[model samples]
Target: MALILVVEDDRLVRRLVREVLRAAGHNVRTAVDGRRGLRLLASATFDLLLTDVLMPGCDGLEVIQQAHRLRPGMPIIAMSGGGQWLKPDKCLNLSNRLGADRTLIKPVSPQRLLDEIRDLLGA
Candidate 1:
């Protein structure tokens, strides 16, 4: 099982993801926003980061940039609900540019999420 960090501003989403990852046998850690996510990244080691694309504080792209700088090849999976104003494609493209290993739209199935994570991490 991989150690997964889940970063999301929405409380419900965060809880769901944490529960899913834990149930999948992953060691899970969570942060409510990008800033806290970055702090966690600095303090602990995780096999992957699963973060929402848009957040209240620092965005997922910025978090990806910072995390990449800290851990050059760390894997990241960025997700987005598109937030009314933003497009999913735009978020996916930006996440790709920022070095996310993969991107997923919100409301993704738990099995699919686990599959993507495994595929990216090659586990």
Candidate 2:
């Protein structure tokens, strides 16, 4: 299994992702926002990064940019649930343009998430 880092501001979403990854036998680390996510990246090594695009501060795009700058080959999966201010595709597309290795729409299924992780890590 891979060591995965999950970054999301939504507590419920973050916990759900962490638990899902754990159940799949991956060692999982989580951060509440991109800032904390980056800090975790600096302090530890992870096989994959799964992050939500929309956040209160230092959003996922910044995380993607920094993650690539720090580790160009690091695999990243960017996710988003669109809101009144932005559409899901808009943010997710930008994430791809920036550096995300993958983009998943919000409400991602456990199986799908696991599939992506496996595909990325060759698990």
Tell me, by TM-score, which candidate is best: 2
Q: Each model's TM-score?
A: 0.96, 0.97
In terms of TM-score, how similar is model 1 to the real structure?
0.96
Error of 1 at 109 (Å): 0.6
Estimate the overall C-alpha local distance difference test score of candidate 2.
Answer: 0.92
List residue ranges in candidate 1 displaced over 4 A: none
Task: List lDDT for all candidates, in order.
Answer: 0.91, 0.92
| Number of colliding residue pairs in model 2 | 0
Error of 2 at 80 (Å): 0.2
Q: Estimate, for each residue in 21-66, the C-alpha lDDT of model 1 and write its tens digit.
A: 8898899999999999999999998899999999987989899999
Model 2 misses residue 3 by how many Å? 1.0
